[model samples]
Target: MKKNIESIFKAHLEPKEVYKGGKNIPPSDKKIYKLSSNENPLGASPKAVAAMKAALEHIDIYPDQTDMRLREALVKDFDGKLSAEQFLCGNSGSEIIDIILRAFINEGDEVIYSNPCFLPYSVFSRWYGAKTIDIPLLSPNYDLDVEGILNAITEHTKIIFLTSPNNPTGTYIPKSLLDDFLERVPKNILIVFDEVYRHFADAEDYVTALPYVLAGHNVLGLNSFSKTYGLAGQRIGYAYTTPTIANYIRLIQKPFLLPLTSIEAAIGALNDSEFIEKTVQTVLDGRKYLAQAFDNIGIKYWPSQANFFIIDPPLPEMEFTDRMMEEGIMVRPVSQFGAPGKVRITIGNQEANEACVKALLKIKS
Candidate 1:
């Protein structure tokens, strides 16, 4: 008889809850308004669907193991000017995050991330036996403190993941501050810029960390088809960086992680310029409308440049989130994100946005 198998997972396994956006319902119900996950309220790009459909018959063939089509589509903005070697495609922006961590982190190595930022980065850092350095955001806006970040770096520090228009808070790093940080950071430390919400940014000079990649610095920019292209179901995401670094990550990732149809769909989404434009407009309009609603209702919200904003409710964040869920309107509670009294509300479609406001007003009353 075999003895009980020992748990292989290391000691630092601080389990994170797998989030389900809303209550699962039978197909009989017509609609459920979900504003929990920061997903595109407008669904997948129509052209992406057409492209995926076109590739349906070719299921027998495996996807390009190297993810050529997806990479090519991402760099199309450069007139094919950017080399294809500088990209790595994988199962979601989340997987790419995993790949980078797997490639760079090791025992005793250090991984740094902003607090109340995307949860996965911190979660995986612990998973890989690296020490997780959680940095708290400074006042008014939860901004990345350049000086504090620089001070945290040590010889053991291998990576820093910064989320622009950071999750939950939605406050972005200023151009001048980012530029200053880049200049001061050591060349050895690779910076991972999670630009998943970059497309939602409204500021003109809102500096994204992409230029760090283009400038041949130790930086890589992560993007996903989930939010902007509305392909979360397809699970395609990518990293853009200098050829050498990108190739390193690509080499570390498992082959064929991205499905052929997903790559094809991404290509289609990119080509359909109008759908992408419409998605952008929808998010912008919805966010503006929600901001006005929040203002009129006297609910304080942090300045957001993304598809979601941080609601600083007078009641506890967990209470607010639970109350909204009871109303059949799901929103995210950042109380678990190490922040109390704050909830992240995604900017949804017209109906969803209106319903959420109505729920909030009712709860307030």
Candidate 2:
């Protein structure tokens, strides 16, 4: 009668450690600057806040199962190059990734991604019983290893996950490199571009994956309102691809995947062009400020096109993180992302940026 619960769930007896983001320290009297998660320090759009408040009045009603309004809004945002049918909304970009895996991955299949990239690609692939392949990035610059990725492809390769302005490292694949890679990749293998940090990228040579989708290639571009629109808590994101692929993902997704408030808020956020501009500008400014400060202090950090950048601290990464926390600053130690002895810091508002620099100076002394 003690029975065997493990027998029923044998495949997941020893689950991998779940992916985590930055830490959230509890409230205290001292001012604590949280630059852990790459959130919009300027805060959410006023329009989005208003929309969410308005939606609360009808909290009992279920959201539209079709998600037509949001998809149409996205179409308009893209200037009609992408049809509404080509877009699929999800609770977040990460959830859309899971859905993509569910739609295409078979047991014993293979998925490939760059090492030190986003953690979810590996974690989710394993969850679906797909073999995960890690292609190490080019050293010194941490750029994606296109050739290595191409060499690793086998008949069993089902998907390729690429992150631009890659998490924990902040490096991006050049447009020319991506074009070359796309041409060589088999048409049957689905390619997913996780462009969650796309809005913050100002690299002159950077290219989005939308053009590939428009060209009828087997590619999907995933985006989020969380980082740019400050809608992380709302849990809304989307993917754009060919209508056929979008339909396949939609088939696997449960109805009412997102809440009513999140849909309305995303629509409102989409319309708030001024707010998005302000948020991007703030991050750009903070990036410059922090880079210069780090240089003055002789702290080594990467040149980033994203909202956060990785730094090589003089001390061990965990020790540096602990010291930062002691100074009422919370940053991410990115060993989990495959870059041990390195730390990732989000570009915050002017006040938070200055406080972070101050903490660095204190820690250095």
Best by lDDT: 2
Give the alpha carbon lDDT tens digit for every residue of 1-365 in model 1. Answer: 66554555566665655433333332434355678888878898999999999999999998787677677777795467567888888888888888898899887899888787777777778778888898788876787877788899999999998888788788888788888888999999999988889888988768766677778899888888899888988988887888889877777777777788998998998888888888889999998999999998999998888899898875787788778877767787776675677888889989999998898899888
lDDT of 2: 0.90
RMSD of each: 2.4, 1.3
The residue ranges of model 1 lying beyond 4 angstroms of the native Cα positions read 1-4, 7-31
Top candidate by TM-score:
2
lDDT per residue (tens digit) for residues 176-203 in model 2: 9999999999999999998889988998
Q: How accurate is candidate 1 locally (lDDT)?
A: 0.83
Q: Which residue window of length 10 is worst by lDDT in model 2?
A: 6-15
